[model samples]
Target chain A: MTLGQQILQQLINGISLGSVYALIALGYTMVYGIIRLINFAHGEVFMIGAFVGYFIITLFKLPFILALIFAMIFCALLGIFMERLAYKPLRDAPRIAALMTAVGLSIFFQNLMVYLKWIGASPKAFPRVIEITRFEVIENVYLTSDKILTLGVALVLMLALQYVVHKTKMGKAMRAVSQDKDAAQLMGINVDSTISFTFALGSALAAAGGILYAVSYGKIIYNMGTMPGLKAFVSAVLGGIGSIPGAVAGGMLLGITENAVSAAGMSMLRDAVAFAILILILLIKPTGIFGKNTREKV
Target chain B: MKFRSLIKMGVVFAVGFVLHLLIKVGFINGYYDHILTKICMFIIAAVSLNLINGICGQFSIGHAGFMAVGAYTAAIFTKNPDLFIPAAIAGMPRFFIALAIGGSVAAFVGFLVGLPTLRLRGDYLAITTLGFGEIIRVLLLNWKFVGGASGYFGIKPYANFLSVYILAVITVVVLSNFIASSYGRACIAIREDEVAAETMGINTTKYKIIAFVLAAFFAGIAGGIYAHLMQAIMPRDFSFLVSIDILLMVVLGGLGSTSGSIVAAIFLTIVTESLRRFQSLRVIIYSLVLIFIMIFRPQGLLGNQEFSTPMLKEKIRLLFNRTKSGKGHTSTEGTE
Candidate 1:
């Protein structure tokens, strides 16, 4: 391949990579938006979702559509249960406690995967649902079957998420709770249910991301979530952690920038992109793009 | 008052001496001795970690990074200690001098890291620190001059049971003294409320930096000892898992309690080694233990209190009157 073509392929790969980040960031952004708590375990949920997806196909021999649904449903419930069991009780505790709880729970889930060898310690091969030979989409431009599927799935889910957030009663409740939990409760929005729903929705999105992640990477490992999770977190922070659209923007921007940087012969620069962006955005506009920046109360 | 505290230390020292003799003459075993050495190392790590977690009140998740920094720096220096040890021993004693320099170097790095990121709170701070740790691991892995991913080899073994216990004891004492000092109180105040601490004229930033630097220093010294004991060091030895293991000791030991860290470190390290018998079930069971602790005993094995006699009495009374017990009384209390 020519230098220009290789650079183009790398950019395409970055965008494709960026799309998954946007999906996971949606989870981080929404939860932080409503609860003001960063669910560090969310990434682990993504990992679990990938495992679920793998099992659905490999163990149950389920169809692609069914596997995706099962994974999403499985992860959604897991997310809800996590909130109910671990997070809800510690609501009144210090933020540090919640943070610690998230870290502990994350460690728990990751180790569970490691110990059971549930999906096996090694990265399992993702089931091939699509196959296309290397073919030029345009003159000297080639696209793989995997990249198209990932982009298509990510875009579709994002739109669906937008619809739910903009047009549903649950969305209103979520917004109300995010705005003022006490007032939302007084207004009879069932604050508890809304929070649960938020977790469910966020987790489902993360699951979707997870499944797509497995599909795109063509392998699933016990530790597949750590780097991607961190990347999503950066995305959420970059676009203004609480804003949905901001997450998408942040994810895409991060993906493209990282790709361009790598094309410049610095593969190690990938993680630096997110941190540098976080530092810059935090210093300049700490609240983020769509976020109503608040300050530390004395 | 400090002199009086020093006198109290003298009595504790005698008791420690007796315990050491009993274990030594009584056969701690090569296997058990190995476990004890790790426990002692963990004790130092956990107590220092508490400086960040309990004292400064920041949820520091990147402790492994500092540990690695200390570990590698110590490994680098001690790799050829014969050249430096003689000159230092002729003057200020090689062991103490090398350990101090190792710790000081780690502390300086901690200061550099803490300055920019400490302002960020909670998980942001955590993930940032975690990233730093990963960066450190990769750096050590790729820095071929040191030893690359294979890690540096051939450090002379200077650490043994005696040095491990001595250093561990000194860490507990010095850290306890630190937390008991005005500097320590300022750290607690910052943890409780940074805004209020600042209002009270404590430079919150400065104190947080101090706590971080102190934690890094001890971790460095421990890493130094670890380098000598292990005789070879690798980047993998100080991954995020290493941080979590130390954190388990801290949380299980009751965050700010000095004796709690010592006891918990010893207990957990031994338990971890034993759990190795379960093979694959080891980490899973360990996770379950942590989860159970979070759900049922969020205050940890002893909460923020220590293994004092009065504490033992209160704990017994509380256990008996457990049904009548409440949250606030059980948690958030100082051991002393």
Candidate 2:
């Protein structure tokens, strides 16, 4: 293949992967914005979502769309459950305590999934629900049906998220809570429910991302959410933690950089590259690409 | 004060000598010895992490990276035939030298990392440190000189329980002294309120970095000991999970409490070792314990309180004096 063709192919691959990252990153950025918590178990939610999707398709012989929807609903409920059970009690505790709880929850879910005998700590091959059909986009560049489907679903969900955040009453409440919880409470907005709703929205997106990732990668594991989940966080930080557009942009950039590095024959450095970008961005512009600097109050 | 401190050191050394004799005479068998050595290593790790996270109020989740640096560097020194003196001269002296080199190198790396990233606060600082840790692990994996992903093996077994125990004691003593010093107070002040500390002319960043470097130094020594004990070192061994394990020890013991760290480390090592039979249930139980502890007792098991030797001595002295003075038995109970 020509250089141009390779570049084009990598871009397509990067965008598909980036879309998955964006989906996960959305949950991270939203949670961080609302509560100033990292929500470490968000990755585990993605893992459970993939498992949910896998069971729906393989066990029940359901259609792909149905599996995706069901996974999103289950994950949304799980997210709300986690918030109510673990995080709610520690709402006024020290930030470190909450962070530790998140880590504990992450570990709990990962091990719990393994403890369930039916779902051991082994990778399962994702059944291909969509048939692959390649289309030549350019002289030597090709696009697969899986990539197209991933892109399409991610775009649709992201757009829906955008609409929910901008064009809905809940979104307005979410925005208020994130901006100032005390004022939002004073404004008669149900702060607790809004926070729960944020978790649900973010978790539903993560579920979609998980299924999309499983379908594209053709395998799923109990702990598969760890690396991607971390990378998605890096993307969230890279773009500006609290900004929606920043998460999407950060995800795409991370995906492209990883693919470009792999194409340059340094695939081993792919994971390191994301962290390096994260550190550099943190040092140079801690507020991120689109984040505005806010002064600390005494 | 100097004479008292010297006597304390002598007592510590005497205790260590007795323990060493016990291990030599097979009173403490291999299984117990292994657990004891691990307890020592974790004591060093947990105490050092407490200095950074508990005392200095800086959240560093990448301590294992510094530990890895120390382990790999010390291993390379002792294992390489051509690096220094001949094999005939290579013994305790050589091992001590390698440990020093490892510790110094880790401290330098800590300085490098802490200088740039310590300015950030809370979660951002944590994520940055975590990134540095992953970056270090990746770099080590790619460096073929240290055997890369296959790990560096055949390290000299110079780190016995005695050596680890002595070092762990020394770490605790030094850190306790440091925490009592004025510098330690500054670190505590920063932890309490960074802006307030800065307003009081504490130079918050400098103190934070100092604590970080000191913590990293001890962590390096602990890593060096770990490499020798295991006789093999892998980059994967010092992954993020190991850092979390150390953090768990510090948090469980009560952050900023040296004695608490020591007790917690010993308690956790034994508990984890005993649970080896049920491997899968072990982590689940462990995590559940952590979650419950965080929710119910966020201040930790000791609640930032220390059970110092002096305090114990004072209590014992008071009990003896009360009995000698022929005070009522009820008064003796009130003394406690």
Expressed as tens digits, the lDDT of each residue in B212-305 for candidate 2 is: 9999998899899889989998999998777877888888889788888888888988888888787667778877877888888877767788
The estimated TM-scores of all candidates read 0.90, 0.94
Provide DockQ values for all models, in the order shown: 0.37, 0.63
Cα error, candidate 1, residue A70 (Å): 1.7
Candidate 2 docking quality: incorrect, acceptable, medium or high:
medium
Error of 2 at B43 (Å): 0.7
In terms of TM-score, which candidate is strongest? 2
What is candidate 1's lDDT per residue for A1-298, written digit by digit as tens?
A: 7888887787788888899899999999999888878888889989999889888899999887788888899898999999999888877776777777787788778877877745557768988867755667666878887788888988999999988888999898899998889899999889888999999998998998899888877898887888788889888988888899999988888898888888888777666677677766655676677777576675
Interface RMSD of each: 2.5, 1.9
Q: Across residues A1-298, which tens digit of lDDT does each residue of candidate 2 receive?
A: 9898999999999998999999999999999999999988999999999999999999999999999999999999999999998898899987777887888888888989888998989999999999999999998888999999999999999999999999999999999999999999999999999999999999999999999999999999988888788899999988999999999999999999999999899998898888778768877987788776887777
